[model samples]
Target: MSENRLREDLCFWAKSLFDRGLTGGASGNISVRTEDGGLLVTPTGVSMGRLDPARLSRFDAGGRLISGDPPTKEMPLHAAFYETRQSAGAVVHLHSTHSVALSILPDTDPDNAIPPLTAYAVMRVGKVALLPFYVPGDAAMAEAIRGLAGRRASVLLANHGPVVAAKDLEAAVFAMEELEETAKLALILRGTGARPLEAGQIAQVVRKFEVDWD
Candidate 1:
């Protein structure tokens, strides 16, 4: 896709996320790997609801800002995924409600934030890691992601929200939505001993969809 079109697509999906309350204020960031092997990212302290295509932050393959507004202070979070995951074409981080709420629950699993609640979640988002809370924008968050060594494509920050990476901008957003919805389902079923997908069912879905299971 052309750079102009990629910028437009990013803005379109970003506004969709904002309008649906997936992210509010400047609580999220998005980046897409450009065809030139660079990146077009949302600006720092900007709402996803009102991003400007022309003013999006542009970074060269060397990681230098070549144009547009400055990138987010939480950029290292995006960088960690791009560096570790060779095929990560885009990354989306959102301060989504249910996912963040799930991260705060005492019983939520750290290694797998949400259980195998449904086949769609397993196929689209895979296992969602729940990492310890770090101060927003702390480099430690990036280091923690590095610890995962790119095995996890989605992670929920304790008391924060979720970060998801996929092969492109649209896929990243779709996976983010799946993660959020599954988190909501997990919260709803808390203490119910909810019967998630059986081991065999999960295996079938993973194999059928070729899920990126870590």
Candidate 2:
């Protein structure tokens, strides 16, 4: 997409996430790789619901801010994906309620954040790594994402939020929604003895959907 269209789409998806209560206040950020290989990103401190496309931050491939406002404090986190995952075209970080709640559950899997509860999660998000918590905007948070690097397409920042990288803006948003929905399912099924998809079933779906799961 053109830089202008990319900005408009990022703002549109940001508002959609906001409208759905996936993020509130100024707590989330989104970025996409422009055709020229620069980044078109949501501005820092602006609520996703009210983001302005023209005001989106711009960063060159070398990480220099070429125009617009400075990018979010979490720029390194986004940059890490672009550097590590060759296929990543967009990145989204969301402070959705249910995912944050799921992250705090005592028995939440530390290694594999979300269970293989549904086929969509497997197909959309692949395996989600559960990263140890860090202060928001900490450079260490980006390091945590770097720790997994190319091995995972999504991660749950323990006690913080979820971040997802995908081949495009639509895929990124879909993956984020799947992450939240999987968390919601986890909450609803907790202590209910509900059966999650078995390993064989998960594998079958993974194969059937041609998912790039790990």
Candidate 3:
């Protein structure tokens, strides 16, 4: 896609996430790799609901800001994914409600953030690492992401939200949506003795999808 089209699509999805209440206020950020190997990131303090395509932050392959607004304070978070995940073409971070709530729960598995709820969730999200929390804008969380060595593409920040990396912006958004829905289902089924997919079933899905689960 041309740079113009990439900009427009990125904004469109950001608005989609915002309008669907997956993110609110000025509480989320997105970044996509450009054809030139740089990135176009959502601006600092900008609501995903109201992004201006022309004002998206543009960074060169060397990580220099070449145009538009300065990137979000969590730029380190986005950068870490690109650096660690060779296949990552886009990164999305959102402060969605249910995921945050799930993160705060005492029983959530740190190695696998969302419980197995459905085949689609198991196929798309794989094992999401529930990372340790930090002050907003802290780079420490990015280091945690680095430590994963890109074996996992989704992570839930404790007391915060979800961050997803995928082959493109659209796939990243889809993965994020699936993860949020899994969180919602997990929260609803908590204490109901809900039966998750059997271990063999999960293994089958992982084998079919070649999910990079660790």
lDDT of each: 0.93, 0.88, 0.93
- The per-residue C-alpha lDDT of model 2 at residue 97 equals 91
Clashes of 3: 0
User: After superposing candidate 3, which stretches have Cα over 4 Å from the reference?
Assistant: none
- What is the C-alpha lDDT profile of model 1 across 66-145, one tens digit per residue? 99999988889999999999999999999999999999999888988888999999988998899998999899999999
What value does the lDDT take at residue 93 in candidate 1?
96
The true-versus-predicted C-alpha distance at residue 77 of model 2, in Å, is 0.9
What's the distance in Å from true for residue 159, model 2? 1.1
- Across 108-129, the per-residue lDDT of candidate 2 in tens digits comes to 8877778889889889988888
Candidate 2 or 1, higher lDDT: 1
| TM-score for each of the candidates | 0.98, 0.97, 0.98
Model 1's lDDT to the true fold? Answer: 0.93
- Cα deviation at 84, candidate 3, in Å, is 0.9
Query: In model 2, how large is the Cα lDDT of residue 142?
Result: 79
| Candidate number with the higher TM-score (1 or 3) | 3
